[model samples]
Target: MDGAEREVATLLEQLQGLTSNAEQVEGFRRVQEIVQHRDPSGAERRVLRGALPLLGQIVQLRNAALVTSILQLVAQEASSASSTVTTASAETLDVAAALSAGLYEVCHTVLLLSHSTEKNVVLALQLALGSLHSTFEVALRAETVENGLDTEPRRAWDAATRCLEAAAGIVAIVPEATGSDSNRSAMVWLRAWKFVESGVMLLSTAQDSSVYRDPARSNIQPNTWSLDRLSAGTQAILPKTKLEEFGVMLLKAMCEAVTSKSDNRLPLQRRELSVAVNSLSLLASLRPQHMPNILPKLTALSTVVATPGTEDPVVQKSLTANLVKLLSHPSAQVFADEVTDILIAVGASQRAFSAISKSKEQRRKYTSAPTEASLRRARIGKRTATQSITERVENANAHAKRRRVNLSESSATPIPAEKHWQLKKVRSECVILGSGETQDSKHRAKNNQHWCQFLMK
Candidate 1:
């Protein structure tokens, strides 16, 4: 690497060390100087990007005192810049965007940490309101509301619907207005609402309530990219798949599948549903492709049956009332003649009747990432021979005899499709970046190249 790049790389390592309280002051002081003295147009911009890890660390700290301090600092600096600041630099808007994003991501993450104390949660919400306050105040002086933050780690926008709605419903928004004249109760609520949408969008990118996660959904392990053919990331993927984009889609579609309007039927995006079932059938050596559209309907029903918070045992019973229902009903024959966990999850009393678990072991061989494939192959092979014998036995029993029988017999049947799901575990082990080493590691790795210190910690 060139000398300039090496210098920037070194800066990232130093920044990560700014985590303790004493170092924090120095961190902010440097930040203050950057916002106050540097321009975004040149090499200083790289410094700004490199500096974000400290900001990320700040958000992770969850100390109300620190959050408030940074909030006020960013707001004060942006507002104090001269009106001519618009022509001289894009500083106000950029800083405001960064602060808003930081606030939203941190608050949203904190609320999701089921392990956090009530105090931390309250502080997070308060930080949220402070962020909102800065958002609107910035509007009073800043020219635009467009975001200029990096998009790695992807914002949780799709999950922000509720926050946006609540922000819109607040009463007595704008007030009477004039030039810094009246001691204030005279501000324009209407103009404030104009920025409200943008403001809401900014916060909702995170601070999005619908996306709140339980600590149950956090990361399982770090992906340490090593040189040897041996790798270990596969064990990490399966647990969190259901919380991914497609998994969320699967969850949403199943929840909406059979409304009161559709008694005998279940609805789903047949295309995506096929991709999923197809993968399962192909892997299990079953032929679900025979009734492409027909089987997925049953599969969607199975998902709804397994989804957490679905309390009505009647739904499970209605599905189980008769044996013929098992074969002829929509979900019964999902993959040709195979009776499977797909049926068991819905309370099928008889033998599970399908073969899906054993086939999953084969999944290791097909993994494509060289590192991950090696990792899985080595771990599963070795672990299976000795350490994983019990786990392997448990894996088989999970699909075969014990749980399936109990499920068929009891009304309290919750087929253990995925372990550790919430409200009784619906198989949602997503990689939550709320607060922990995993969050810090992933966030750093995501921004490391262009904007961070070190790869994922």
Candidate 2:
């Protein structure tokens, strides 16, 4: 086993040392064969651990195959952090360390350009970023690390911020990459924002209740991303520079979503935009300077969706009330005078102003009472084919499951066995003559249909 490790390491070095582009490509393929064909105990992890660094080697070569191999490896191997080398172990930083500027530049270039766009590349990039964010999320939330460093701003944290940048930068380019999946782009935005969101939540203890919150969020599970819920450190300071970069990227993403109206106008995509508005509002409250950058986009949010109300959050809070909750959040002090006129321009109702004075409970009072969140996701009057199939399967399983005796509907006492039918049955010699019932039957118990069975005759 030691010999095999040496052999793999030796092969990797030789692969990197090769100057000829053609031979290096061949050598790269050979390395994959050696690791995987040899049937190592953890072939995927080994291949990934060995291949991730290979990305830098091929960056100058411009070989999509090599880049794709590493990405596909990361996509497949990094999904389960428990088994992969990227897990939150002592060597956890290894994976983050390998996310070189070369890798980011390559991914960013491929993701941003339509002609260069590849689905495999996109999928792999999404998986890689999401996995890294989730992985470091634990360390950031830890009370203290093994290295005695602060929760964030360390090597691991620095790499995590890189992941946020990479993800958000891809989000900014999603509109231009005409062939890329809009859904995937939205997901990347969500992942990037969530990483930032957790960081802020951990640092901001005083403002938890003060922020404009979605009531539906109260019912959902908190985004811990860890098995044993590690809360954030209130005193942990976030890097102001990187935090501002996230706000900037979020604004870019929101702009792209609007510009690509044909692709992003659906309820789901619009819902994502609404969440971004709320998130920007949250960031602005913490840092007032973000308000100026975020306000125009919030006004552009005149196109809010109707569903997802009272779900994770009411989109822009107005989407929760279908245009009623677009109040002037305190973050909008810069444009306080224009908010009402803007809301009016966007077709917001009289309730938009009236609801401002309402209390938190009262703010949501005007929420569409009919649009209840079913199955914890608020969707109404809309069902895709997949959702229809899912609902059917769920309903079938629900019907097959046994009901509690206490909760089951009581039997109707046989509906009193209609007296007219009973009298007619008696005339036809088919009256029941059970011991508890009337024994005034016209026929013996054996002859009565009430006591009959499918006898063999």
Highest TM-score among the candidates is held by which one?
2
Scored against the true structure, residue 401 in model 2 reaches a CA lDDT of 65
For model 2, the superposed segments whose C-alpha errors exceed 4 Å read 9-30, 33-52, 79-116, 141-143, 147-156, 166-174, 177-206, 210-293, 300-323, 328-337, 357-457
lDDT (10s digit) by residue, model 2, range 1-457: 4454557667767866767767766776766676555636452244445544545444434455555665554444444432343344434433433333224444444444444324544554654455554444534433244553342224444554455555555545432223354424555556545544444433222232233343223432222331224333332424444444554555555445433244235424544556655665554443334456655655545433322331223454543342233343443444644666655654554655664544224233212223345533545356688989999999887766644342344332232346545545644764446667644443464455542222111
TM-score of each: 0.25, 0.51
Give the range where candidate 2 is weakest over 10 consecutive residues by summed lDDT: 219-228
* Candidate 1 regions with alpha-carbon error over 4 angstroms: 1-12, 18-20, 25-27, 37-50, 61-68, 71-99, 113-123, 130-457
Tens digit of per-residue lDDT, candidate 1, span 1-457: 3443345445435645656765655655655565446544342244444444455555455344455555455334323432232343345444444444544555554444434344444444444544443443333223232342223212212212222323232212222234442211122222222223233222211211112111101221111111111222331211223223332332223223232224443232333223333222221121111234334444555555545644345444433332222343232334534435455655552534422322222222211224666677776776645567788778898778876686566545443433222313211222335555565666554543322111111
Question: What's the C-alpha lDDT at position 164 in model 1?
Answer: 30
lDDT of 2: 0.46
